[model samples]
Target: MKDAPLTPPLCSTDAVLATLPAGAGDLPGAMIVWEGALYIGTAPGAGEGGHARILRLPWPGGGAVEPVYEGPEGSAVTGFAALDGSSDAGPALYAALAAPGGGLILQAKAGAGAFAPVTEPGLGEAARRWIGPLALWGGRLVAAAGRAAPLVGAIGSAELLIEADDGSGTWAALSEPGFGDPGNVAISLLTVLDGTLLAGTVNPARGFQLWQAGEDGAWEQRIVDGAHRHVASPALTACAAGEGELLLGSGGAAPTAADLPADAQPPELLGLDPATGWELIAGEPRFTPEGFKVPAALEGPGFGWVKTARICAILRDGATITAVLAATPQSARPFGLPEPGAARIWRSEDAGETFVEAAALPHPLVAAAAFDEGLLLAGLAGGKVRLRVAT
Candidate 1:
């Protein structure tokens, strides 16, 4: 085995977009390039309390930043998604805000109108429920909101909700734990592949489960990992190499115990086919690249993982898929990314068979996008954004 370099940089950060002013929210979340603008949602940063901000930067220059939405206290933007305009509902942007002491999902017209809450009544207990990512499935906006953190006793539950894009108030619970897994407490990811909606969950008792549903709302569940106490399997992206294929990233962990330390099991990357089920891509890791050492915690069978950063965003360029990773600590604090440096970007050539660290961004990376001018936009921690010109 060749020795891997200690610190390898992947892409070069060449330009700066905008730096947040003092008291502005820092951690950026779900980002979507819709119409001709790039929309970025943010989470509360240090000393901000519970405030969140949504910024819009135009494409060509992407210099002038517009505060699309400035949320009130106790509000943090969690996710964002865009719906292509139709005859009924014009193009609109949806945001999932961690409010309600629990979570709230909101929507607004593409380029006009202010964001308004669209969450259903009596979904879960306040302060405990939180919504995961958002996606548009079969013309309807969909998201998962459930009970995740508890003050005491057992953790609560989660459910999938659907709302029309035409500004109607028809909010409904598409499915519940009774409709799927009773132990699913948090829905981490909601994505579409081959016209099917895929959902990933974080389960405390049963690890994580991946669910697939059609337009009719019938869901089929599959257990992907069951060894860890909390399986933070939220990252999901399409495979550009193969048609209708999907890649799922799992952040596994074993709860703190007397003899066992709170092990941050390296994130797992799995590939799913329309025909075959979920297949472990890095189950038997080669650790081929030099200077990359398999951490002592990730050394056993099916544990030889490469990327330790939690999967944030996956960008597919041609046949190569780039996985953007973040280092969120186990203490549950926000943006544990190192100072003066950023997160790692890993590239895979043959699907998920292997991954090589490509480049590094300045500051911890929360979201990324490819611009029309052949530049990559990376949203970093501390309200800073930059552009990566080349790989």
Candidate 2:
């Protein structure tokens, strides 16, 4: 997965920080920075409408724009994790909130001022309520609730992978809920990489699945549906680890069924290799149980178009990674959206091996950060939270 170039554009100053109209949070899922401050979290737009806040900003040196933490009306903060034991207030932080059957987790530190509720909402289960992604393994924290999607919050439909313990708000159930596959549905991403913990599901019947969790915690199931490139599950959103492998990023085609032909699958940039195998750096050219694959991007897969949806945020930065290339509301109302920007940016300075296609913007990042000079994006688009400061 390494031959393909021509895809460069990264200047960015197209910042907006907050312009989230309609009930305030058009979309801006979890991001973090802590001490020098740069929080960001907000989600709920389009039928859920908005009410999931947490914007701080003032990092590497930029200011004003506070909003703290509000969430409740239709809820949607969805994920964040830090934890460092008992909290003399330096690390701790958990947060989830997905509302509906009432899903919650909150808890903060690093000079904390607010963010409490240590879990009571759906942690016991009222159908689980969509709580996806948030990582940190054996030391606890973890997360990945379920109700899976549709009304967005959970009243039942399976999905659980819980953890928590370090600061003990007590939580368990490492798998079994949907791990037993009620057709999987929403585990979306948990990530640890390197030390390995990963869990990415979204199974719209039989596609997206990745799971991993050893060292006695059990849980395995490497890559099923997507290994077949059944691409559909928010185009397999994000996953990042690097070096030894595991840097998945498919552009979420977000269709859900309008005749579900795998929601028009088109978005790829994978490379897992090292156990269950499966490589394909671009997309389209399958045949796997771990065999054929091919495409390294000569504009193959969505990287070249067909509506570049999926890969909403990957972020790495040591050997350089940075993905994020969204486009979906069912591909902007029924077919091939690309014209006036839907969100774009793809890079890879050797970590994920290879990639290009840089900058196109208009919103669609979930979270990003990298500063020594600047590179801090927090997009959710139309629900606005846009802030791409690369200068």
Candidate with the greatest lDDT versus the true structure? 2
lDDT for each residue of candidate 1 in 1-391, tens digit (9 for 90 to 100) = 2112324655544445555454564555556667787677776654457566787877545677777777656566666778887736678888877654667776778656477766652233455345656888877777776555211124645677777555665557878752466666566668778678877765545567777885566777643443122333322322222445676555532110000112434455555675756555543333322223232222222233332434545555555666655443323324533433344566766554456766655454445544334335454443444433334
In model 1, how large is the Cα lDDT of residue 299? 25
Task: List model 2 lDDT by residue over 161-199, tens digit each.
Answer: 555545556567787876786665566667777677877
**lDDT measured at residue 146 in model 1 versus the true structure, 0 to 100:** 55
TM-score of 1: 0.75
List clashing residue pairs in candidate 1.
Answer: 3-290, 3-291, 4-290, 4-291, 5-291, 10-358, 10-359, 10-360, 11-359, 101-127
Model 1, C-alpha of 28: deviation from truth (Å): 1.1
The local distance difference test score of model 2 is 0.62
How high is the CA lDDT of each candidate model?
A: 0.54, 0.62
